[model samples]
Target: MIHSINNLLYFRQKNPGIRGSGISVNDPVLLPVLSELENLKTSLENYLSDKVEKLKIEISKGQANFPSILHVSILPRNQKVSNGIYVVMCFDILGRGILVGCAESITNPKGLNTVIRKQRGIKLNIDVDGLRPTTKYNNVFENPREFYFGSIDEKQLLDHISLSLDIALYNLGLAKKDDLTIAEKADTGANDQAFDPQNLADARTKIARQITARRGQKSFRDQLLRAYEYKCAVTGCDVVSTLEACHIMPYKGDQTNHIQNGLLLRSDIHILFDLGFLTINYKNKTVILNKEITSSYYGQFKAKKIFLPKKPSDHPHLDALKFHNEHEFKQG
Candidate 1:
């Protein structure tokens, strides 16, 4: 478990004086910790994605004078946190491996205390160059609170970090409780009812059967369903419940809901498309995935042409696709 940061510790041990003050990832002294940082980033994303539906996990980027520290923050999906000061959980190589802190003063000390007491982890003073002064490292940890992870198991470490994250999110009314019973059942196979793929198929079939009777304004979703023949354009999946009407360009209003601006996609695919992890080429209509997700389950769809509707008029708009690929997908 401690192997994740062994290289980081070794690097810090060799250079006690040189703090690698550069904030960019290109720093020479930061090279040894990149692998571990990326692995930790991926693990955090995967673990938290399972719990939060619309989460935005961000790692700090370039900011001059900030130490070469990995500040992993769990930002709220749609709101400014604490009047624009985001809470952070950082990995401090020279100090404690994991440092929990808020970027600004808390408005609700009672709530913060509640979360801290519930977690019951050892809290220590944050005595490190990266986290000590707010004037120098404004975007890094401020009002730092340390949660010791030394000599702990991996599961406990994740739990502590997750609880620290939850404290921040919870104070801002963004916390979503995980159904531990369901998670435990899934983990131990102690659930009385076993999962059946056919059950999902039956549910989807039920939704598909009701599509015709459903009354609506020939809405974007209804139109996409008709345009794509009730199938996902990328996977050809006919699960009506899982199918979603996706806007190639972010939806602005009624005008942006044109059939040409939309694609019938699976729910997960729709999320990925919106989040910029996936996109399609406007000219070739071939699927494109971000390198980060190339090894995951969605990787198989890479380079595959999306299934098109029979009518040429119903194809995704070239301009909209280009906008998404250029502005959204590539940017991500």
Candidate 2:
């Protein structure tokens, strides 16, 4: 449901925007909206908004296949963005293109060339500040498109952008890489840890099997504590008995057994994390608390980065963090 302005539905007209007004997708109605987006761009990189207003915002419209596209690049500021990464938006004055736009991070270095345009995709987040229950799913952008144009709430549209950015980050190996120190991947399938038929003949054998299972659980806990330097990743609760090795992703076969799938949290935090009331935003390197616990002690830890393993190899896999964010982490 991530609606974009440049989606292939509009391709007939030639005029993308008003001329000499700073933007190529020339629509006076969207002036306020663009201003807001500029604010977001500056907030993201900071240096984009220096004391001098000498920032040259190179503006151009899409030609050939994309007639409705308005390509704006903030020049001399974000070399990473203005260089190859550009903000491509569809000016929706005619009711065909979407009001929401995207900041593309394409692989092409030269940018604006015809070849890169043909491939399509690579983007980020931008959110309107006032929209209570605002859309900040992954990478929280301070100011975004919904500041002005259109009727009704555009929070969903902004959320769609954040969601897309989350996916892109996961795919590009830029985020969500968690590696557990002590916990091993669980054998989640029915076949795994299934009692052998021969061993089930006696009650004593069944007891022994149960003991073995407990031992395996202990191993998982031991490894997690070691990975986290024997302290709770959340509260620094060093009480070994109170610490628990918890899985970020739910147990779902051998795939959950990987060490990167686990997190060493205090018992209370582990329970909360499992319940989706608490989570770690690995990209931001901070802890996130759901509304249910926002007023509690856990909330105090909000925006505070958690402790990670010392070794790079021990870092959790990026995919695991992404999974926890999308499917588990509760956010605005």
Candidate 3:
């Protein structure tokens, strides 16, 4: 079958203009065989296309051109065929001439020895003039598992290819830089002071010593105003004088100054909450106002979600919520 296909390829190359010469080029027996061969080639090409797409994604992530060569050293070579036959086959398949001028240089004239020694491993000097610059190599050897092809480690080759792409992309200004310099500086200073075991122990003991004395450094009003951008969490009112940083847990109860522990509420709601006229359910992160506040006023505020930051990760701390639910939520 291989010989017949080779003959057809040779004939087609020699007589490129003889498509319809009343010959058996379109013979029914040949037609199905050729169709099947074409289908196989198309399938292989499609499979290669997917592989190329994955490589392209990796390249785009790092701004680099794809590697030029994918060396598969274990390609199959026939030991029985003559150097002339091997050269002819290489030329027909790869569209480039294989040099076999030194075929007689081999001591034991095996076909593989002659071809490998004389022909410089089947050169395919592909013309890149008209082709796009983004082309990737995908040529496959049919019987690659038979010869030296099985010796190369596939995983190692892939890793090397990936590393090459990473380096190329880094060089091409594709990788993102870490922008936490200020945070790093603060961490470094903290680390230096904490490095000594005595200092660390002293700091922990000091924190324990002042556990009860530790009050919220920033007022509820100050913290809430800053947290909500100085706007009412419910009404979106920007009057800084009227805005109060209402604590989820009262100042005396929970002394943490974290923004998540507070909300910027209007004066009326702030007064209601400070007097035990309102509470928040921590589980669903919802507000629950006192029943006596009247439906017209409290209904507008009840079941209405708080205006927290856009990021869910930046949402008020669950620990603060847990404290509120455990101690503050007005149970029916």
lDDT of 2: 0.47
Q: Supply the TM-score for candidate 1.
A: 0.38
Instruction: Judge candidate 3 at residue 47 and give its lDDT.
Output: 33
Order by TM-score, highest first = 1, 2, 3
Best by TM-score: 1
Name the weakest run of 10 consecutive residues (lDDT summed) in model 3: 140-149
Separate clash counts for every candidate: 0, 20, 4
Over 42-142, each residue of candidate 2 has an lDDT whose tens digit, in order, gives 43334334311523444323332222233334423334542333333333323333323334333332211111111114332221111122211111211
- By summed lDDT, which 10 consecutive residues of candidate 1 come out lowest? 110-119
lDDT of 2 at 288: 80
Residue pairs in steric clash, candidate 1? none
- Sort by lDDT, best first: what order? 1, 2, 3
Per-residue error at 27 for model 1, in Å? 3.0
Candidate 2 backbone clash number:
20
TM-score of 2: 0.36
lDDT of each: 0.59, 0.47, 0.39
Every model's Cα RMSD, please? 22.1, 22.9, 27.8
Q: Which stretches of candidate 3 lie over 4 Å from their true place?
A: 1-223, 253-255, 294-296, 311-314
Q: Write the per-residue lDDT of candidate 3 for residues 56-109, one digit (tens) a residue.
A: 210101113211211111111222211211111111212121111111111222
